[model samples]
Target: MFTPVTIETCITFHGHVCGGISLGYVLANYAMDKLGAQRGDDLYARMECQNCLVDGVQCVTGCTTGKRNLEIIPGGPMALTLVRRDTGKGVRAVISVDMPHGLSKEEAKNHILSLDPAAICTFEEATLELPN
Candidate 1:
């Protein structure tokens, strides 16, 4: 079985697990599965915000800023577009639910992790023009 990277891995990279990391972990896996992508594939990630979620995306997709494959554009929303460089095709996952308020950090993380990708995000097909 191809085990998807666990949330614990993202938590280790992110220094802590929170709602954003949980959401990112779930959505990144969903996007990769939908696109038939594996970690370290020739993929590009365009992120819409800078937050803990970025770390989760980085951890799961292996598309890091240092590798110049992940770009943060600061669009003021929690969203990500993961594109396959070879095909210019991708999936965009936009946050559709607000992070639950008044919950402990661990509680929030667990709650977000439990949600289906469709429950926390709305996904759309995307086409990207990536550099060679």
Candidate 2:
């Protein structure tokens, strides 16, 4: 049996806390709650982005490359789709916050390290079709 995952563990597993990590945490929880799906068993998360967000999803949702449930489509913006196998329900979300702008590299770094990661991003949610 798989132990339930926590946000704290996800933060640790993803190496550093950031907007992407929080996005993953929220996305996974949202799917589990809305779709009545467990993270480890029937829920598969497919994300488009080759970045930190994928790591966060992998860590928190028990979905990863090894499980054949996580797919990373590179060269795309940050977005995710959570699909529940048993019910064929899914949720699609895209980050509502625009990418950071006008900040120096140092400022960007500081912003990433100091700001509330969860506050930096919000998702636009909608129903979606789950892949067969």
Candidate 3:
């Protein structure tokens, strides 16, 4: 059986979750599929965004810096890359589109703060390599 990662789970890991982290969870799964891999016993999550989104990836993927399964590079385009620890196969995840709710900036903040998954993020996938 397969169960999807939920926003509640992200909240527990983040201690303060947001749509970005929730999206990270989804994107991580998507990236795994694109890379012909699964979370399995070992994997690497390469991240670009330094925002709250990283929290979700850390929790859902079980690939945190503490475990040496994650490597983050700050000050770049907001993106994430996952590598298989054994095979070296990898995929990069990037947000291609950010859905808008026609609300003011403040409203957007309120919505995110309210734990809304209303913000839809479309992704464009690419095959990539994590440095060996």
Candidate 4:
């Protein structure tokens, strides 16, 4: 029997990259509420750029006012990962719900169509571990 695998979508926001962590938190909260995820539950994951440089030089960065790895204001990068609890059904539900929030259905369909055909896979099939 073929077991259904959980599907997760990773959204990458490219820009100045600064304040990405804060933005990621805000977006995650919005997504969780929009997706009806429980509070204190791990609905999504965020990754912040630690050390990045601009113009071949290191500078302070980030949304919070303080010294950071880089000096660029928007040099930070943010990544949001949405994971489905159930394998098949949850994936479909999440996609159906979040597609409209970020990108329109038509745009999402087109984007998916533009992707490499072989890139489709399951999130549960891969083991992801966060650093302590």
Name the best candidate (by lDDT).
Answer: 1
> Poorest 10 consecutive residues of model 4 by lDDT?
52-61
lDDT of 2 by residue, 41-76 (tens): 676777878776777678766878897778778877
lDDT tens per residue, model 3, 91-113: 67775546236866445445544
Tens-digit per-residue lDDT, 1-132, candidate 4: 222111111122222322222233333333333344443333223223332112111111121213222112243343223333332111111111112246554455455444432232112222123223
* Steric clash pairs (candidate 2): none
Where does model 4 exceed 4 Å of error? 1-18, 42-77, 87-132
Deviation from truth (RMSD, Å), model 4: 14.6
Q: Which residue segments of model 2 deviate by more than 4 Å?
A: 1-3, 99-132
In terms of lDDT, model 2 sits at 0.64
Model 3 residue pairs with clashes: none
Deviation in Å, model 2, residue 33 alpha carbon: 2.8
In model 3, which regions exceed 4 Å deviation?
Answer: 1-4, 99-132
Ranking by lDDT: 1, 2, 3, 4
Assess every candidate by TM-score. 0.91, 0.67, 0.69, 0.26
Steric collisions counted per model: 0, 0, 0, 10
Model 3 whole-model lDDT (C-alpha atoms): 0.63
Candidate 1 residues 11-103, lDDT tens each?
988988688888788778877877789986889999998988888899888899999999998857888899999878899888788878999
Overall lDDT per candidate, in order of appearance: 0.84, 0.64, 0.63, 0.27
Q: Please report how far candidate 1 places residue 75 from its true position, in Å.
A: 3.7
